[model samples]
Target: MAKIVIREELKPKRVIALMSGTSCDSIDAGLCDVFPDLSCKLISGINYEYPEHIKSKIFQIFSGDATIKDICQINFAIGQCFSDACKVLISEFGKPDFISSHGQTIYHYPFDERIDNISLKSTLQIGESAVIAENTGCDVISNFREADIAAGGQGAPLVCFADEKWFHNKNIAIQNIGGMSNVTVVSDSCETFGFDTGPGNVLIDYCMQKFFNKPYDRDGKIGFSGKICDSFLDCLMQDEYYYKNPPKTTGREYFTKQYIENALKFAPQNPEDIIATLTALTAKTIASAYERFVYPNVGINEVVVGGGGAYNPFLMKLLRTYIPKHIELKKHEDYGISSNFKEVMAFAVLGYCTYYNIPNNLPSCTGAKHRVVLGKITKHV
Candidate 1:
């Protein structure tokens, strides 16, 4: 690979952050100009959809039966996709200082499971950073959750560190509804923490693919068309994870096709009802998280929403209905950030922190033993 060198400057150089969440939908990437003051500018961003066959392979692994050979190979394939995303961004925005990738989260364990009398806790984020480094010829930082998990955390809600920077000097909840929903509560002191609230767009998108042969319920229209089945909604809400305390994380392993299959036994027969109920579940659980964990302590003034859920008019409407009127709810766009790009942008900042040896993981949010710099760097040379 021919490398293009960026001249070092006093200001933090531009960086490219690439991400593919558990949703397995598309690669979201951003070009950000990070500053020493900790503020950042999103110069540009793009969403690269995976080819049908590649997406099929992703779902294949999500089924949990893929052999090690499949995982080993697909990891590289996904890396190439990530690299391609960076290439596109570079072609448009020029070479960045480095690259940060929140690779595909194949699995994220919420709690320790015992085996051989030892608590086994782990998480996997494929798409090798070495591949990104080699392909982009820039330093690549990735595998952000491993260190936190090793330190006895749920290995999640890492964005809390960046959320602090995003809304400094405010008592706010930055709720991102990606494959899963998580809330980062930042106090006026700039002290920040968060955890997985509950399911987000992942469940709704899975239902869309399963029932309507669509990637997602565009604008949550299918969900809007159906009535929320109260009984079924209650049953779905019964999941203990929703009620669990903070420092928790989950993935498709806990809420996926098999999950829906089990729920179908008691769910209303109408697919749209099931979809609507799931949407309500997301809205309700997110609000419940804030009401239970956030509002009591900080009395939040704003709930800035981001990610795919922000685009779902019905999901936003349901969230609005559930949230208290005392707090203002706004989309990321209102703050001049693209809903889909915030997480990717955040990772770019994380990568910058890691490079400077700054501690990036927030112990309060991830339950880590202490603050530590997150992500491993792979050098191109």
Candidate 2:
């Protein structure tokens, strides 16, 4: 190991932040100008699709069908995928001061599950930083969750740190409907907090593929065409994850294929109806989570929606229907933020904090015992 020096000056840094969310659809790479104040401006962004073969392997691991050798090999393999994504940005924008890679989260177990007296509150994100550093000839910061988990946090909904910094003073909920939905409540009345609201597009996307052989319900058209089964929606709303208090998180590990298959038993027979019901489930859970956790504590003035769900007009329509009429509904673009790359920009801020040795995790949101700088640096050398 080599001694690493933290940056002392408050200078702006150009960073290329790379990540692939729970969707595992594409590797999102964003080039940003991160300022000393931790504010970031996205200079450019790209969605680099994963090679079909590599993507299949990731799904295999998610389904618990892969061997240890497969996991070991895919770490570097996905690192190469991330590096390739960075190269696309680097070719046009040039090499950044450093690269921040969130890698790909294969599994996140922020639970109280114990094994042989060992608390298994852990997470695993696989793209190898050393491979990225070596291939790109640039310093890389990866594994942003371990430190927070070490501090007794759930190691998730981490975007709240950036949400607090970016939307401070505004009484709003930055709701991201990614593969799974999560919200960061930035308010003036109470401390910033957030958690996974519930399933986002995961179930809908799965059902779309299973029923229509499509990747997702574009503009939520399929969902709009069908009627929502309220009986089934009620059953889904009773999911235990929605009832759990905040400072919590979940991923595909909990909402696995098996879980989805079991859920389908209660679903409507029509595929479109199932899709519509699942979309409503996403919207309803988000609204219900707020009614339970946020509305009581914070007087939210607006709900700014982002991620793939924002593009789903039907989902947005359902959200508007379920959420209170008094509160305004807006998109990330309204605030000059890219819905697709906002998470990428958030990691850019986290990496910048790491470079300057600043504590980046928000304790209130993650339930960490304290603040901690959240990434590991892999130097190009």
Candidate 3:
């Protein structure tokens, strides 16, 4: 261990942010120049595929088939994967001031489930920061969720902080459709807030792999070919998660393989229809969330779609169909943001705040009692 000095002067810092969303698709690494004012510009990025063996173990954990030893070993394994991803960027862009790693979330239990009379609300993101630091030779800031949860927050939808920084004063909703969809409502009238809107590509991706033997619904072609089963969509919309109030969040923990299989019992005979209905469920839940939580509170002038879903024409079409026609629908690219690497860039900003000792979590969005700086710093020796 070494004494890590925090830069005292406010200036631009080049940071590389690494993350692998619940999709478990790839490790997304982005190089960004975070300015003193909190604005960040993406310099470069890469989607590094996980080694087949490592990826299988991750999926095993998701399926609840992995043991404690597997989880323990995979932490460093994934850290090495992250460090390798950073090396790719570092080789081309050079070493950044530091690296920001979101790691991979193995389990996120945000509920206040009481056990032995003690409320348990916790999250685990596993790429060991020390491993990342040692491998990259750069100070690393990781585990961005723990502090927020400790502060009585759900420990998610952290992008809202960056959304507020970038889209404030404008009545807009930044809807990110990733493994799971979430939205941040930035308005001229009220404090910025956001919540998980429901399934994004999670169910659809699962069904694609299970039935079609594909990784995902690329460009949503399969989804486009099928008709949405309204009856099934109705059933999915009834989920309690959809009805829950804001400052809420969810992930693979709730939408597990068992949950999907159970829902499939009521699904249409046609697998494509099942995919279509799941896709529609995503669009409908997002629109429903807006209708229930957002529209009544603040007027939105635009809705910006980002993440992997932005590339899915079918999902985007459904979103456009369900969202109000009057409100403009745009992608992150339209605003000069990289749709694939937006979250990567976001973590860069979060890490910048951490390095500067600035509070990064949006209490209004995450339901923390107050503002607290997120992330733990691991200094490179």
TM-score for each of the candidates? 0.95, 0.98, 0.97
What is the TM-score (0 to 1) of candidate 2? 0.98
Model 3 Cα lDDT, one tens digit per residue, 245-275: 9989999999999999999989999999998
- Look at candidate 1 and tell me the lDDT of residue 365: 90
Query: What is the Cα root-mean-square deviation between model 1 and the actual structure?
Result: 4.3
Model 3 misplaced regions, further than 4 Å: 1-7
Question: With candidate 1 superimposed using the best TM-score fit, by how many Å does residue 307's alpha carbon deviate from the native?
Answer: 0.5
Best candidate (score: lDDT): 3
Q: Please give the RMSD to the true structure for each candidate, in Å.
A: 4.3, 2.3, 2.7
Error of 1 at 378 (Å): 0.9
Candidate 1 C-alpha lDDT tens digits along 92-200 = 8778999989899887775778889786788899998888888888999899999888877878888888888878878888999988898899897535889888889
Q: How far is 227's C-alpha from truth in model 2 (Å)?
A: 0.6
Cα lDDT tens digits for candidate 2, 233-262: 999888888999888899999999999999
